[model samples]
Target: MTDTAHALGASRTLWELIDRRATLTPDRPVLIQDDRRLTFGELRDGCERVAAGLYGMGVRPGTVVAWQLPTRIETVLLTGALARIGAVQSPVIPFYRDREVGFAVRESKAEFLAVPGEWRGFDHTAMAGRLGARGVFEAYDTLPADDPSVLPPPPAEGTSVRWIYWTSGTTSDPKGVLHTDRSLIAGGSCLAHALRLTPEDVGSIAFPFAHIGGADYLVMLLLYGFPAVLFEKFALPDALETYRKHGVTTAGGSTAFYSMFLAEQRRRPGEPVVPTLRLLAGGGAAKPPELYHAVVREMGVQLTHGYGMTEVPMITMGSPDDTAENLATTEGRPPEGMEIRIVDGEVRLRGEAVCQGYLDPDQTAAVFDTDGFLITGDLGHLTPSGHLVLTGRLKDVIIRKGENISAKEIEDLLHEHPGVGDVAVIGLPDADRGERVCAVIEQPPAAPPLTLAAVTAYLRGTGLATHKLPEQLERVEALPRNETLRKVLKYKLRERFGAGAGADGG
Candidate 1:
């Protein structure tokens, strides 16, 4: 496939494109909230005013602005404002508690912070107070009740940093990913092409605008002159309602979230059917084939899988016309300007999409091999047709008696079990062998207890390889996941199980 000509322009920067949209489509709906909406003109004015405010506060081209607001109009303005002023916006998911937020603020060395006054049962003021007291951030509340009007600031452009994001370190510490004006525009353009977004398309965003997925989708919508319905928080039902009410043509999310939402929606049927919805797109984690089938066959929408990270934003995305097998199994092919290769079962990506490197030079050097290919720790293989099929994490793969095991494969199979609610499989050190597969399970309140014997029996019945079957299984109240509902703290299980935990020990 050839790169789409519409995906890029010769000289237009991201800020310039946004300015053109605001100027050309001033009266058109740019953002829609429940009972309120902002036309392109209003959004532009808001961004300008916010940029002016930041400038008064001494925000400059290279400054890092950490934004921790819930989904709202402010998130839009803050993001756009930062882009216009050449300031780097580091979006932190609002759901992150103290430790996570503290880590982001400290690591990013944010000069300024923006958050809500109160949102979704969280006290924003207190959170802001804590961040402010930490001595690195200057926090501001985004409630419309206070400081409603502000001045429009002068444009800041050319040679300015636009955004900074953090990669989700499923197997290691989070690494900082930076984007300049050119790169961000490139990313948005790639996303627009991958999703085939158009001027008439409308998107409702449920994910927090702080992450790359959220920001990429938001910017793509704007760049294409499409309207975006912003959510202050994730409410599955509310999101569905928005889909129906707005006749949302597209939406973006993670595999886990889209699975949960699609599962819930399939259980009940009615009007507000959202027949207009063409694509339900997501990435970062592998989605079960059943979930993808349900979203397509049952719900009558395309469940497109994409592949990207904070380091390389939206590099590949499946098309609506993709085969069901492709949609369910692979992460599609590379987007414009991206080059991908698989060496020794590990995926390597390079191009404008690649990150500038981690905040720490040593860490950055460690992650990227020579020749500039990002040594994505993800274990994947290129299909005969060039599609990328993710197997599991390189560090997360379990080596049991010389047999390599994919934790994701086992976890996916476990999710099909009737009694299992959620699970995380990890590799723990073993004296007899290099490592052993251990599963930490979270069952529903009414579900019966799970045992190692039962798990092995289930795996056997499912026809999984004996080597891939978990040697140890433990039922826990819950597994530690991130705010995105992604399993992150699997190390805790290995810690508790101890290095030498055996099959019988569990």
Candidate 2:
């Protein structure tokens, strides 16, 4: 327990916050998915009935409930209902393969698994069975209309587990991130503050609800009594239509999503800008400088970048008032009451929203210090204005002829190439230079396979030192990414390309 959690105290748990908001704005629209609309009162009613039903099903306080629900109102209700009953909610991304799904179920010691029957061409029951969890409940079947009045009381703060988020582990193996009741509240409140979300803003999110962005966005909108619009999946045309149809004023997604939306905008000219869409927000990695500028010019909306991991939630974010340069280059200032510092090229943070630690003790010990700072593996320097600019991950640094090079810097440079869709840079162990830069790229169908000479020449044209240019370029159909669409496991690419393999295959 930390004193900061006490200072930023709330009277009740997050469920109570939702209940209080419902009381204040009972008739206000709360959730909209496709054609279905739910008011605060109705949302509360559904949550109550679901919570009561879960209680009847032998779910008790402190039980871990794993849900593979899609981006639907049922998932929203289940989250709130679990919070009400003091049960820990672990959301399994719908795209998880057998190994990933099984690991999550075993890692969380989930007693009950809730999943949709069929979603996005995947069968949840079949996937859940492989995970060794018993008694899988279908999403829609769980909502019984009997309206059982008994519901377990909210779990005690600090003692109750809110949710366990598993990182993509670009730098290391996956670790279960544990958050407390205090952390979730502080995180959501900070996000609502930094993003300038209001009761009038219709919060729209296209990312999978399993990720931190979608989960926190849903909670923040409900906590602030704002209308939330949930998208089943990412479709630029459908997203634009929904934004216009729902009068959605605020949206959250990733840098890639913003880029895709901008590309769609280029295809359709003179399209009416969703006048109500005032804020376009992205988090995780910073957007490319060129992509950010083009989005602002093409979409007529401000792009604000937030910075946070699964552990700390939304710790920093670019505000609507931030300068274009700030929004483009940095991760913005740390959220209110969050402290960040740079030491030995690593970013460290301490705040109420920071989690207790990873589930494994070894992982916890590796990431935290005795002084209570979370050592983020990212390499960055904090500006004098209190903003944090991410340079690259420390592990991703490549050494060429005794000069340290950032892979992310090279990736950003490669992104400017019209033919390149996505790319990842990795360090191949070299006896001479210690490590050499190798790039794996996904190129456009119209573009011929990239040659090593072409990549080096491109780097040289940009004034990169000759030694820093990649010695090899490999083309691949698709880069391996996690459920959140973040590229990790570059070792797979290394196995294929680091051995001087040709671009003909993988």
The number of the candidate with the highest TM-score is: 2
TM agreement with the true structure for every prediction: 0.74, 0.78
The alpha-carbon lDDT assigned to residue 297 of candidate 1 equals 71
Q: Candidate 1: minimum summed lDDT over ten consecutive residues — where? A: 139-148
User: What are the lDDT scores of the predictions, listed in order?
Assistant: 0.69, 0.73
Tens digit of lDDT per residue, candidate 1, span 1-506? 11322533322455666677777678889888887888888887777777777666777676787877777776777777777667777887665555456667788888777766566666755776776623233233342221324434334443344666764354323456766656666666677776777778888777667767666765576667778888765556656777678888877576655655565666675532566877888775556666778777766778887777777776788877677898888888777688887889888988875777777778788878888899978888888877788876765656443233567767878999988999988877653343667888889999888778888998877655455677787777878767776756876787887555454544
Question: Model 2, poorest ten-residue lDDT window?
Answer: 1-10
TM-score of 1: 0.74
* 313-415: candidate 2 lDDT, tens digit per residue: 7778888888899988887888668988778988888988888887788888988977889987888888888888987664565544223456776787798
RMSD of 1: 10.8
Off by over 4 Å in 1: 1-12, 131-161, 168-173, 269-272, 397-506
- Candidate 2 runs further than 4 Å off: 1-11, 140-148, 156-159, 170-173, 395-506
Residue pairs of candidate 1 with colliding backbone atoms: 71-232
The collision pairs in model 2 are: none
